[model samples]
Target: MTAVPVFLYHAVSDNPPRWLAPFTVSPRTFVEHLNMIADSGLRVVPLRQLVTTLLGGPPLPPRSAVLTFDDGYADFASTVAPLLAGRGLPATLYVTTGALHASGTPSGRGPFPSAATLSWGQLRELDAAGFEIGGHTKTHPQLDTLPRTSVREEVGGCKREIEDALGHPVDSFAYPHGYSSRTVRTLVWETGWTSAAAVRGPSALSSNRDDPLRFARLMVRADTDRKRFELWAQGEGAPVAPFAEGLRTRGWRAYRRARAVTGHPYRALPTDEG
Candidate 1:
């Protein structure tokens, strides 16, 4: 079983909102992680390469890893992109379309907390710069907990919004807060998404056998210390994906759905926080 670390990141900044701080990594630490990946001889490949392999197109080069960022934070344009461009690395950035800052207002109403998010112009620039821009829903909502109609709107509507903005089709989608059920995944595929990202909790690495629509990702957070990250880079600390969804996951989903029905759904937070 060849393990591929599809590293997930959020905001990369020294100063982040209190709510986002747990998921944020400082620029210095981000550089260190990149350097460590290079030192370990692991190649950072574009996410589509891994997706192609998962789709049975071809085998990935040995020791290949992926870089993906969820939620379009302003720091991605201001800090993360320059660093990645400097290293000549490829990455995929999934943006919550509604949360994007445009003019003096958000493009749409998103469920995310108050923070500096990427604007549409910045996203276009990032796309032009060779960064793969993917969809993270119009408003960041838990897809599994929403009604089927709403799921379609969120899943398909987001693809349309990004395509309208970018003037090209985007193939990748990521579940908000890493929550997705079978229904949600089906909706995503019906909406024409080729690959979708999900957090398989901590210590799980995506592999060739992982589901293209619900591939696992190893989240890199503020608390992800050097030792743990190094181990992940070596594919030694995490279990490879394509595992069965356990009873605990189903129970958690039930609880969240119940909360949603009561109009008191869980607030958006890092995937591990729930």
Candidate 2:
């Protein structure tokens, strides 16, 4: 069975704020990426549909792939959605509800930069336009560091909020910072989400047999050139899995230990590392 690549993005802008500039892709680059996928004869499907096909609902199309964006950045509505709409592609947007209400401000005293989270109005428009909106917790926090109760609130609360705002069910989730432990996974499952996405680590699932909860995604940052992006689109980007996982595992442990000492689940600073 051939694995489908789930491409992950954060913001789409040529003039991204200082802190998030690394993760943000220019609009031209985004368009090029979309064109690459379309020209590759690959089908760009919704993440939920991809999951269903992977789980036995239907045989996936040849070279099926998924696009997902995290944090519900304003650029998603302004930039990403337009390009996706033009391509007739579907994507999943995972929102941190707290940020939506926080106005145009960075959540903490870090240089994370000030940007507007998507408004309720914008989210509703996206839902109406055939995009899936998933939960990324009430506030973007490291789920592994929080107690189970807080984890439940963060995960469950965000789902309920999106449902209330959109008048539809949210069936998917993506871990903030791509961090989750077994307990966190269980909490997400109990909250009624059918699937969840994580950034980095291993390559994407080669078949339906892979775990649904820990679905791996290829993090596409600003620096991803056309050659590397093509490698990913063609599903030939797994050559560096061992090296990538090694770095991810070490960074995850260090963050876990640091959070343990600070008793803080939320990160105050923006990072170049995904």
Candidate 3:
């Protein structure tokens, strides 16, 4: 069997009443979740270390796992950081350079659902503190929509920025908005990143031709109950769905739903555009 699942998370919150909007696993809940992973005998591996180990001589633990957070939320530093440290677990934090500070707007993904995104300085602290830091992008732009030049710049520039800040190479990436494509993956590899993550779930190994930057992820969300989270982490819950073709359709449907609820009208992208 494959070593272990790669789990992705947003906010490990202390008090997120609903999993829908806030997307936080309350700090108390987060602790429980962490304890669960720890007790399950899984090695909480960082992405780089996991990759390096698998490529080296020895095999990994039967329950090895990679914990990665996208968007560089502030809670990562203020909340999740200490907890992982206490458990002696290593984590990889993927960040969007745009949201690292006061430079860009927050995601509709939620209202400050992750109100605590990290800054460049905070990122450096995390890097210096031994947390592995990686890139998302400068503006969190959808990688597939941009032209080739923009894709290269967005992918490369953010890695460049993080490396410049932390004095270490940013060798991995997570697609912004969980969005990517063949073109985007090519650009990511061209940028020389070792690996990259996607929002899809049910983790497995990539074959030789698989894009190094296009790995999938499972989630232990704030809303997940212990049983479901366990099943998910164990790869027995829901099978990871291939969702690349659903983007524009789902997004447009969601937009329409929001508009209808608010009694507002909107124009969706032309049917041919997606």
Best by TM-score: 1
Tens digit per residue, CA lDDT, model 2, 44-130: 877877678646687677688889898877889888888888878889998888777433434332122376567777888899998
Model 1 CA deviation exceeding 4 Å by range? 103-109
Sorting all predicted structures by lDDT, with the top scorer first, yields: 1, 2, 3
Query: What is the C-alpha lDDT profile of model 1 across 1-274, one tens digit per residue?
Result: 8999999999899888798899999999999999999999999999999999989988888899999998898899989999999999999999888888775565324555677888888989999999999999988888899999999998899899999999999999999888899999998998999999998855489898899998999999899999999999998798789899888888988998999999998776845621
For 31-109, candidate 3 gives per-residue lDDT tens digits of 7778777777666776775566434535556666778887777789889899888888888898877667643544323
TM-score of each: 0.96, 0.87, 0.76
Candidate 1 C-alpha error for residue 10, in Å = 0.3
Candidate 1: the clashing residue pairs are none
Which residue pairs clash within candidate 2? none
Clashes of 2: 0
RMSD from true fold, candidate 3:
6.5
Candidate 2: lDDT of 65? 84
Question: Any idea what lDDT model 2 has?
Answer: 0.76
How much lDDT does candidate 3 score? 0.66
TM-score of 2: 0.87
